[model samples]
Target: MKIEVITLNAADTLQAQEFGADRVELVSAMNEGGLTPSYGTLKNVLQSVTIPVQVMVRPHSFGFVYDEKDWNTIKEDISIIQELGGNRIVFGAVTKDGEIDEQLLEKVIHHAPNIDISFHRAFDQVKSQTNAYKVLTKYKDNVKRILTSGGKDRADQAMDELRSLVQLSHELDGPSILVGSGVSPDNLATLHEHIGASEYHIGSGVRVNKDFNQLLDKSKINQARDILK
Candidate 1:
């Protein structure tokens, strides 16, 4: 399994890399659930850490539903990331009725043919994960990962659904289930035993006092790394 840490700046990426993070998701405006980091920050972070950095491509925190202007902005950000030698991104879009926006997803994949996109937590808003999983697997080549909370507020609290999703992925050679939210070192073993996912995304879990605004706690990160191993 891989441990993906959420990082706010170049300094955080360095800390994450030194502390056994297999990967890091770079973003800004974390208080609003993450938005795109500035170009300078992205460039500095990519240079600061050797671990794979997955940049968040979200244009806004208002919702997953997007318009033409939003689409253009997302495409623009992707171009910049690719130019900076970044070939990994985290993004997702949904329809008004909460279905995966296949149109937008397709456009992004085409826009960044060389990039591997991890469909972000916007997937949690879908009406049915089973149906959404089916939609995602269609573009499994580009949508290489799904960062979800098992369609709930917390992945640990949605074991039954997560287990089923994990099984479904195995059956279809589907994207890796990058489980996120409510994941802490205290409960990682239990979540792994129950859900058996291959990747874990952590935010506010390995931070000092479990606070997102606080610096990442080295002890907590090492503890989680040990457990994953």
Candidate 2:
């Protein structure tokens, strides 16, 4: 199994790599559900971490619906990431009616042709995950994966939905599904056993005191790593 840790800064990035994270999702403003990190921070993290770094390209945090300026900002961020040698990018967009914004997604995918794109948790906001999965399948070649909690607040509460999504992904041979939101070491093994998902994304779960403001807890990360083993 692969563990992707969300890091808010350079220090967190280094700690995540040292504590055995397979990959790092670089972002800022966790309070706002993560915005794009500063260029300086992105450069520092890219230089400091040897492990794969997936930069979050979100322009704002209120919702997934983006405007023209937001899309422009996202494109700029993607260009910055590409120039900084970051290969993986995480982002998503949806319509007001709760569906994938195909037009915007195509623009995003076109802008970052050299990078692997992971549709972030915005998948959970869609009206129907089943329908969302079908929509994402159309862009399977450009979208590498989808990070979701099965359209629920917590993945554990929606295991059946997650399992179904996993099965669907396998059947289509499309994008991989990365389970996140409320995943912790305590239930990591259970989720793995039940959902059979190989990729897990953690943000606050591995933090000190489980607080995003604090540094990542090495012990917590080790515990999760041990369980994965």
Candidate 3:
């Protein structure tokens, strides 16, 4: 199994790497549900580790629905990150009516043609997950993965839906889904068994005791890694 860690800064990236995480989902203001990291933060994180970094392109935490200017800013951010050698881009977009905004998504995905992309949990906002999967499946080639909590607070609570999504996605050649939200060592095995997922994402559970301003906790990372093993 592969483990991915959600990180808010360069320090977290370094720590995640040392902890045996395969990738780091880079973001800022994680306390507010994450936003795009500053250019300097992106640059610093790129220099800090060899593990893949998936930067969040969210402008704020309140909602996934975005306006014209917000869309433009997202495109701009993608270009800047690509120029600075960013590994991957993580983001989400929804309409005011709670549907996937395919029109805007096509543009943003086009802007970052060379970078790997993952649709964030905004997938949860779609009113109907079955239809939502179809909408997202349309971009399977452009998107590398989808980060979701199974439309609930944590993986365990939504395992049935997650498993079904995983099954349905594979049936349609849709983007791979990386279970997230409340994933941790304690429930990793159960989740893996339920979803048959090779990849997973974690944030709060791992960072619960972390000091983002300093280096990551190597010991805690080892513990998490050992559990995954």
Candidate 4:
């Protein structure tokens, strides 16, 4: 299994590396779930970490439904990311009625043809998980993974749905399901056993004080890494 740690700054990025993280998802405004890191922050983080860093390209904290201006900002961010040697991007968009925004998604993919893309937790808001999976599968070549909690607040709480998604992922040769949200050292073993997902994402679960504002806890990250291993 690959351990993808979410880092808010250069310090957290270094901590992720020291603690044996396989990948780092870089973002700012983590309190708002995660907004795009500033260009300077992105540059410093890219220079600081050797591990693959997937930059979050979210324009706002609210919802995934974006307008023309929002899409333009996302494109600009992608350009900056690519220029700075960041080859992986995490983003997602959905229609008002709760479906994958295919038109916008394709445009983003077109903006960065060479980089790997992971649709973020916006997948959790879709009205039908299976239907959403089908829509995402159509762009499997471009979207390598989807970070989701199975349309629920936490992965463990949606084990059955996750299992079904994992099964479908294999069947369709679709995007791999990277489970996140509330994954922790306590339930890591159980989630691994039940979901059998190959990739996992952790944020507050790896913090020292269990607080998003605090820096990542190396002990907590190492503990989770050990469990996953």
Candidate 5:
């Protein structure tokens, strides 16, 4: 098991790596659940961090129902990220009626099926996680992981759901679940012992007092990393 921390800038990325993160998910406006960072930010972060950086390809936070313009921007961003030497990325989408947007999912992932990619937390908003999981399995090779909170507001509160998802992940060569949302060093041990997931995505959990505005807590990050190991 390894820790993947959410970072907003090159400084944050450096801190994450120094504090024991194996990988970093680079984004902007984390309060809006992370938007695509500027090209300059991406370039600087790539040059600053030696660890694997997973660039987020989201254009905006206007829900998962995107227009054609949004789709174009998303595609362009993915290509640019790859061109800029970013090998890993995170992205996700959903229909207005609360189902997996198969059209968009396939459209984006089909082009770069071999790249390391993660389907982000939009999975929580889908009507049926079981059905959603089935949809994601179609691109199992491209969609390497699903970052989710077990269809709940918080992952720790939905252990049963996460456990079932993890079990399903082990079958059918589906993408494994990367548990997130309120996962902290204080409770990661319990989550791991119960859910048995191999990866955990931490954001505010590493921040002081679990506040995003505060600096990431070095002690908390190191503790979480040791526990995951």
Candidate 6:
């Protein structure tokens, strides 16, 4: 099993690495969900740590329904990150009716062939997760994984649904199901056991400072990492 911590910004990079997290989902502003971090932040993470860093490609905190300009920004950011040697990227796009915007997502994938792409929790925003999961499975050859809370507010609260979705992901031969949102040391082990998940995502729960991105309290992440083990 792998323990992944969500690094809301650069500050958490060093501590996350020290805490022995398998990977870090680099992003910005968890207060309004999460937005894309700046180029400098990404570069710093790339330089500061040896662990894998998956940069978030979201342009803003608004829903995953992006506009034309937002698509352009995502494409451009993908190019920049790839050029800078980012290991992976996380992002998502949805239609007005709340379906995965395959067209837009495909374009980004086309540009980022060498990088892993995790469809962020925006997967929960879709009108129908079952239908959306079907569509995502079709792109399994392209998408690397799905970060979801099973259409609920938090992973623990949504464990049953997450278990079903995990089963569905396996049935469809899609990418991994990375449970996220409100996950913490307290309930992660139980959730992982309940869902039989190998990967987990955490955010505010591990933060030890006022700034969301500042260095994680190694004790907090380590405490959870030990529990997961």
The estimated TM-scores of all candidates read: 0.98, 0.97, 0.92, 0.97, 0.95, 0.93
Local lDDT at 14 for model 1: 93
Q: How far is candidate 6 from the true structure (C-alpha RMSD, Å)?
A: 1.8
Q: Write the per-residue lDDT of candidate 1 for residues 43-66, one digit (tens) a residue.
A: 998777778999999999999999
Query: Roughly what TM-score does model 6 have, to 2 decimal places?
Result: 0.93
**Clash totals for all models, in order?**
0, 0, 0, 0, 0, 2
TM-score between candidate 5 and the true structure: 0.95
Off by over 4 Å in 6: 9-11, 209-214
Ranking by TM-score: 1, 4, 2, 5, 6, 3
Residues 116-169 of candidate 3 have per-residue lDDT tens digits of 778999998889887988888888777878888888877889999999988987
Task: Assess the local accuracy of residue 134 in candidate 6 as a C-alpha lDDT between 0 and 100.
Answer: 89
Model 4, position 194, has a per-residue lDDT of 92
Q: How accurate is candidate 5 locally (lDDT)?
A: 0.89
**Model 1 weakest 10-residue run by lDDT:** 42-51
Residue-wise lDDT of candidate 6 within 1-229, one digit each (tens)?
7778888555577778877889888887778777788888877778788888888888887778888898889888888887787758888889998999998888876777666888888899999998999898877876778999999988888899899888988888888899888888778778888998768888877777524645577777887778777
Question: Between candidates 4 and 5, which one is better according to TM-score?
Answer: 4
Which ranges in model 4 have alpha carbons more than 4 Å from their true place?
none
lDDT for residue 152 in candidate 6, whole number 0-100: 91
Question: Which model scores highest in TM-score?
Answer: 1
CA lDDT scores, all candidates in order:
0.92, 0.90, 0.82, 0.91, 0.89, 0.82
Query: Model 3: which residue pairs collide?
Result: none
Q: What is the lDDT of residue 25 in candidate 1?
A: 95
Candidate 6 displacement at residue 49 in angstroms: 1.6
Over 4 Å off, model 5: none
Candidate 2: which stretches are off by over 4 Å? none
